[model samples]
Target: MIRLFDSAHGQVRELTLRDPGQVSMYVCGPTVYDLPHLGHGRFTLVWDVARRWFTFQGLLVHYVSNITDIDDNIITRASREGTSEELVAKTYEKSWWDAMDALGVAYPDDVPHATQYVAQMVELITQLLEGDVGYKTSDGIYFDVSRVPDYGLLAGQPLDSLRAGARVETNDEKRSPLDFVLWKNAKPGEPSWPAPFGEGRPGWHTECVVMSLELLGEGFDLHCGGFDLRFPHHENERAQAVAAGVRFAQHWDHNGWVMVGDEKMSKSLGNFTSLTDLLDKNDARAYRLLVLRSHYRSPIEVTPATIGDAERALARLDGLARRFGLVALAGHHLEVKDDFSWSGAALELYEHVAAALNEDLDTPKALAQLFEALSSANALADGGHEEEARELAVALNALFGALGLSLVSASAVVDEISQALVNERDGARTAQNWTEADRLRGELVDLGWTVEDSPSGTLIRRP
Candidate 1:
């Protein structure tokens, strides 16, 4: 069984599924308004790796991530651009998917849009009202925090304490500061959906509650998102489910944020870096490796130095792949218990990786085992143990693949002109003409090959 940190319990616990041999999960996806930031990339990669690892461990995984197509942000963007909200949502949703594809995140089994589930949301709110757990006001319908006894369960605080620290909105009709909106009343120029309550849209918190329960059924296996969502957002979702007399997610998990400096990256803070910008300038695989190098629950700093270090690490993996002629097993499943040949120290290493991953998805430790095996493979090759070295390389790469790391290098496709330039660059380096060598390297890069200096010679591969 895989153990994960349950935000609700404030502890790491085993992911016990509702159905045996299968796992169901719902992860909060992006709000379609602008290009995705690195935070978006980090959360997506975090959950993607988890889902892939679960599948690798021989469980049927049903993953659903939602797209918030109609939100205040979308409306603002639409108004700013002088375009329709639908166009704004569709355009940015495409941008979100493009970034996900570039990062190699597995497409979710279901991508439900907020606009597609307005009716279900309205139904849920109706139940809350009928149950005396919700109330309507001049501005919007709100969830009554007083209705739930343990309102701040996911916040890891007592109800009274949360109420003391809650931000008070002046001129609001909420009974308590902690009470949140179930539905936002519409404005003249905003998009509106008709319901018995009024012609307005669902609040951000309402969509996930209805969608997760509807698609995955009650008591789904897991729910995951960024740590920022743990408060208010996730707690509110949990409250709504309880108010409606339904069981919610069995386990909750949240990944840490991507920090730009000392502060978390955010658009409001003016430190937001676009995922597309990074992928265009650097290898997308480098970003994934950077994520895997750190623990999932720890905040990660993304900068040129860190990304460069990750790129160098990726170069090592690719070099090992080139040396052993290893093929990628990314899209393939491995039944590690039976499918692959396991024996001797190689088998021990594989088991170690599996054990580390099982211990609450300790990817950093698993990565350490992989690097250890890599060093062993190199040492064995140098000592002329060819068969043993190949065996170790294959096993190490298989584990890497299982973790969703690709070992396949871009195919080297050097045309005649590029080849001549590469040859010239090599000659310049040999002659110690650093200036000319740098110039030729830039030329080769422009021709679509990332050049690297190695002890053997100048190495070139597609970026």
Candidate 2:
């Protein structure tokens, strides 16, 4: 079993699935107003790894990540650009998917768009109103935080304490400072759906509550997102479910943010580098490796030096594939333990990986074991222990693939132009022309391919 730091309980606990053999999850996804940043990349990668690991552990996983295509941000961006909100949402949503694909993040089983679930959200708000827990304000329908017991449980603060720290809003009709909007009454020229509460759109916090319960039903196994959402966002989501007498998520998980220098990397901070820009500058896998080097809950710094270090580490993994002619087992579902027959020494190393992952998904510890095994396999092969080295190499690549890190050979994806340059560089090296060889290698690099000189010859792949 995997133990995770559940935010609601504020401690490490075993993840008990609602069903015996299946795991259901809902992660708060991007709002699709602008290009995704490093912060967004971190959250998506964190949950994607969790989902991959759960499936690797022989569990049936159904993951649902929502899309807020109709948020205030989207509307603002649309109005500023003098276009329809739908156009803004559609354009940026495509950008979101492109970035995720580049980062190797898998698409969710169900990506419930906010616009697709307004009717259900209205029904949820109606239940709250009839239950006397929601009240109509001058501008919208509000959820009276007073009606929900322990409303600040996720925030770890008392109701009064939270109210004291709350930022003053313009809506004086709200019962208390802690009260949140359930539905926003429509404004002139804004998108609106007809509801019992009048023509309006649902509030930001209400979308996830309605979508998760509708798709995963009450008491889904896990609810996850970035730590920033732990506050009023997630806390408000839980309150709605409790007010409606529905058992909410059984476990809560949140990953820490990606940092730039000492401050958190965020759009509001004006420090967010576009994820697309980063992907264009380096191998997309480097970002994923950088994220895995730290614990999921610890703040990670993303900088040129860190990315460079991860790229070098990836070189070692790729070198293993090139040396032994190992094939990347990407997208193949194998009976993890049963698919491969391992030697005694290799089996022990494999157990270290499983144990580290089981103890709270300690990926850094697991990766350390992997690199150590790689070093040992290289030493054994050099010492004429070929059989043992082959077993370890095979196991290492399989585990890497299972963890969503593909160790593809450079020969697999290098274009003809890049491959021709690699061949030319090799010919120069064979003729003992060091200057020409180095120049050709630089040319290949400028064309966005990583060049490697090996015993078999030079190989090239996208960086």
Candidate 3:
């Protein structure tokens, strides 16, 4: 039931798995040069939600997100810090993993580093050279864009008309302005692998092409990354596939960047906030809720006020769970009366929120529905329909679990108190103190537990 825009097709498309339940997905990960920012987190949250919802919908999702361990950025960082490239990659790779985990984002099923796939990339480039889709230059190997008839189809541009606002080097060897590098011969002190052509490393675009083809056989259910990648990065990836006569990604989904105070957050800007900094100020759950407020395709603006609001909302959800847990702990699901159905409402709320999540991961709408369900549950609990309220609360908690969100433990203490109340009631009945029995009933009521007197005894439920 998930529908996302395939930027390659310029249309929102339904995701259909070739096998009834097999959902294969790939997302382009970041180059490990610096810490993660809000801008870097947008597409990650998008795919993470997609994985959660796909599993919720009974699909077995295979997610692979690539890590750009070897890149020009890494090289530059190493040089600036007077450190080895391997050391730089190692440090930032761990940083990246920790940041993603703290933000309530789950790791992909497989993370293949670009450095580990050098051999595959070399093989891919060799094939391209042999196929006449690439040519050698004194500097490196470059993809001959002139070979691919539909070179610019994915980017919605014309190769011959790539003359406006271009920033890349206008090399004399390139036949057209769009003929991007497949490999670059090592400059002095830059890391390089000696190849048949020369000592050089693969280009930024080439690693992804090789990685996707090697892992997903050149065709997959969906390819995902930030909208900024739609141009040269993803477009070049598609062109390589077409030149190799292979099917590329079935659908391409791009999540927009997070704007800083006013501009798009990037490492180049001092306005960017690091994930670690955000984590130091807020718990993982609060940070997650902040990100989930907006649809992934839309631009998200990160601010202190926004995150504070997220924390308040999460607190409300946690409180509701605590209230419901107290009631459900006291009785079995089957023995509950019509008025005491917290578990039922919880499940109902879960269904609605899950459906909202599936429809393109409309997180804000899903979160709104969750808050609405919580409100009703709270009202019901406050009104003395303890069991009815418990049902709704359970649903919200389970859905929160599915989204990988965790508030503090509220379920434990509630259960303990409920058991103690039952014990106290039993003690009063044994002593035959009618006066004490009525007093205990009043005490329980005051504490949000309703005790109803019957012909046999008093029936207790969450109020």
State every prediction's TM-score relative to the real structure.
0.89, 0.90, 0.81
The 10 consecutive residues of candidate 3 with the worst lDDT sum are: 328-337
Model 2 worst lDDT run, 10 consecutive residues? 329-338
User: Where does the lowest 10-residue lDDT sum fall in candidate 1?
Assistant: 331-340
Clashing residue pairs in candidate 2, if any?
Answer: none
Which candidate tops TM-score?
2
lDDT tens digits, residue span 1-463, model 2: 7788888889989999889879999999999899998899999988888888777667888999999989899999999999999999999899999998888888889999999999999999999999989999888999999998889999989899999888867567888988899999999999999998799999999999999999999999999999999998999999999999999999998999887877665656545389987888888888889898999999998887788899999988988887788987643333254467756767887789888987888999999999999999999999989889989999898777657788866465666787788788889999999999999988988887777777777877665
- When superposed on Cα atoms, how far off is each prediction in RMSD? 4.3, 3.6, 7.9
lDDT of 1 by residue, 30-129 (tens): 8899999899999999888888888777788899999999988899989999999999999988999899888888889898999999999999998998
Reference-based lDDT, each prediction: 0.88, 0.87, 0.75
Residue 387 of model 2, lDDT score: 89
TM-score of predicted model 3? 0.81
Candidate 1, residue 437: Cα displacement in angstroms equals 16
Q: How many clashing pairs per prediction, in order?
A: 0, 0, 17
Off by over 4 Å in 2: 263-272, 331-343, 412-463
